[model samples]
Target: MTERTVGLMVVAIMCVLILSRGMALAAPPLPPVPADYADKHMPDGWWTDPKVLAEGEKVYMGQVHPKVNCSNCHGKDGQPKKKGARDLRDPSLVNRFSDSFWFWRVKEGVPKTKMPAWKQYLNDEQMWAAIAFEHSFSHKGQAADHAHDEIQK
Candidate 1:
């Protein structure tokens, strides 16, 4: 190709990147981490605890007492609502990080992602329990798009 063509292509690519960066920058920044972040669970220990898993499901599935609502964003059957959220039914992330890291991230929330920290919503026990529940979703055999079942069922 001619040098001019190559230069134009480079400029076009750069413009796309710049536009994308500008779009991302336009969104408001996420909330800062809460002050009480220390002493949370380690990510490795999460999968092994049955109590935490049970409790996590109770909250994640709204089966627990007082019935907190995770079903609004993440689907009731453990699917995420929109594109960017993790599909809890998918397990490519299992054992990907320490169990406590999962707990902390869940408790602390991922900045720039829709995943909210359950810290304010749930206590520590409930937080770890939610982690266990999320891990359990990764072990499932659900169809790719759970929304199909929702409409039919």
Candidate 2:
């Protein structure tokens, strides 16, 4: 209505906008990911697969046949903070490699990591089956291969 009133209102709105923009820019987000990565891609029918995920649930709950329960350290919910435990919900690592890579990791084991070789405890079928279950926890596919070496290899 009045020039002074309009100017004051404009100034107040500008200040509010400036403060909000500053605060938004100042707040740091937790855990960063690469620009090319899709942080979360959990799919449906994850728990429906009796062969992999359902059996993986059994392994997570410690009722799996052939034993070697994963729950002892990784926790029943697939969430663990222990030294060797991995963030099963994170697709970046869970979906890092192909099914074969997962099989190799389970059988041959991850070097220097807490992951132990399961070749002694589980057979190939069981291992791949477990990986299939892991898919329930991981994204559909691997992240973009940013490096030429990775693409070549």
Candidate 3:
């Protein structure tokens, strides 16, 4: 009700805003894509290819190969279908991993996890295509957190 009270309230609000901004600035940046994990040569324009994307979509949907059914765990829209499955739609995580990382993980699979190695059932190209599909949900282009130089090579 008083001018002095209003001024004090404004100052408190300003202090909170300034502190939040500082905290955001103090946060560490996302790590770069690992050098060894970068792809040697990604299929040219494969990420943009309709047919390839279609195949990748099929792989995501578990249509092409029974073992390649990502949606069974990751959900159709990148949400986790089960309790431990990660929400793939999280850009903070998805954008941090390079194409090669995705490919390697798909090929080798994660240890002590539900994810199984898909290399035995699918060839390299199909795996790459599937990565493209997974990345499609949250790719941020060149400015994305992960380095995909190998994917373009």
Candidate 4:
């Protein structure tokens, strides 16, 4: 290819990369949990409890509620299966938010997004269980960050 053509291609690739990174970094900030949910938290040790995690996996896969399959969009392994679904495996996105924030999002769903309010089908324990399973994606072998258990007012 001509040098000019090659140079133009390089510039185009760089622009694409830069724009994508900017978009990733521009994710909306976590909205505040409503007063009722702000105080809700997972039961102690729920994050590491095998039984709880198992239950969470069921919830994630939609076994608990036929209408609530998170894997359809979030993927079985936390990678997004659909466009606009956030990658739950990314620690930068998942780990930074408190458990309360995650729980609130699951319960209420994000506005202007495909994520639907799961509260209609999921109770508190089921929602917390699903959040626990979701954390396993980004946290892997790490212990749960107990510090993020509650939302700060």
Candidate 5:
């Protein structure tokens, strides 16, 4: 082959290799949270597990859970600690979302929001526990009054 033709062939090969590597490194897009997720049941009775709820309290309070520090922006009581934080205790807001919606949000985090994905740091069960604890805050007379003191005790 001619020298110029050989050089062009080498350049084409290099470009292909570079593009292939980039595609391999690219992460897959997160799945869209399903519309019918509200009707789905919790895995293995997560809603009724008192132990799971207790463990979730630790995670929410930044105690022994050892993953994301939820209370930094969410406050000990699930109330927002900052200007843009979601008020966890708002019944109207809490009532708007489903359990599956909460689970997906906690796992994936919201775009353009302060929430970060906890999927890397927390396991599925821990995530559910945290959700239960957050849900607890919206119930009347069930606020996390002593959540701040949980770790200390």
Candidate 6:
């Protein structure tokens, strides 16, 4: 109703925005895949398979297993819902990681973070499926080419 009040409200909103942006987590450094998981790869053509992506979506959405709900932290669309959760839609982050790296993260989980090891609940296929789904957010219809490049690296 008053200029002073409105100005103060705007300043408060700005401060909150700045603080939130500052609090958002930066992408963590890529950790090495352990010896056991180093050779692991997603099924050939899994990225382009409609069935695989669909299965992955289910796993990501927590439909396949209660304990395997990636969406709880990573969010259904890959925009993390919780603090410290990585933003899956970030292309820069996606491009930096290989499929095996993603798989290892899913299977083993990141240390000192909320991300838990899914190996106890998800089989290899299911974990790969979930990762494929997460990758879809960044790669979209181009996953085939992206997968090929990552595999070659």
Per-candidate Cα lDDT values, in order, are: 0.61, 0.55, 0.72, 0.84, 0.72, 0.82
Pitting candidate 1 against candidate 6, the one with the higher lDDT is: 6
Model 5's TM-score against the true structure: 0.63
Candidate 5: lDDT of 22?
100
Point out the higher-scoring one by TM-score: 5 or 6: 6
Model 2 quality (TM-score): 0.52
> Cα RMSD for candidate 5?
14.5
Greater TM-score among 1 and 6 belongs to 6
Q: For candidate 6, what is the lDDT?
A: 0.82
Per-candidate clashes come to 11, 0, 0, 0, 0, 0
Candidate 2 residue-wise lDDT at 20: 94
Give the poorly placed runs of model 4, Cα more than 4 Å off: 1-27, 141-143, 146-153
10-108 per-residue lDDT for model 6 (tens digits): 999999999888777654456677888788888888977889989998999999998778888988788899999999888777767777788888998
Give the per-residue lDDT digits (tens) of candidate 3, residues 1-153.
899999999999999999999998883553444565564334778777778778888888988887679999988877888887867777766755566667767887777798889989898888877777777666532112234432321
Of the candidates numbered 2 and 3, which has the greater TM-score value? Answer: 3
lDDT of 2 by residue, 18-127 (tens): 99999988724323232322232223343345545656556545565555766666655456757777766665555444444455556666677877787787765566
Better of 1 and 4 by lDDT: 4
- lDDT tens string, model 4, 54-147? 9999999989988999999999999999999989888777756777777888999989999999999999999998888888888763436445
Give the range where candidate 5 is weakest over 10 consecutive residues by summed lDDT. 144-153
The positional error of residue 18 in candidate 5, measured at the CA in angstroms, is: 56
1-153 per-residue lDDT for model 1 (tens digits): 999999999999999999999998783442333445444443455555666566666787666635466766777656888767666665544444445456667767787787776667787777766666666666672212111221210
Task: Provide the lDDT at 149 for model 3.
Answer: 39
Q: Against the hidden reference, what TM-scores do the models get?
A: 0.54, 0.52, 0.65, 0.76, 0.63, 0.75
Candidate with top lDDT is 4
Best by the TM-score measure: 4
Q: Which one wins by lDDT: 2 or 5? A: 5
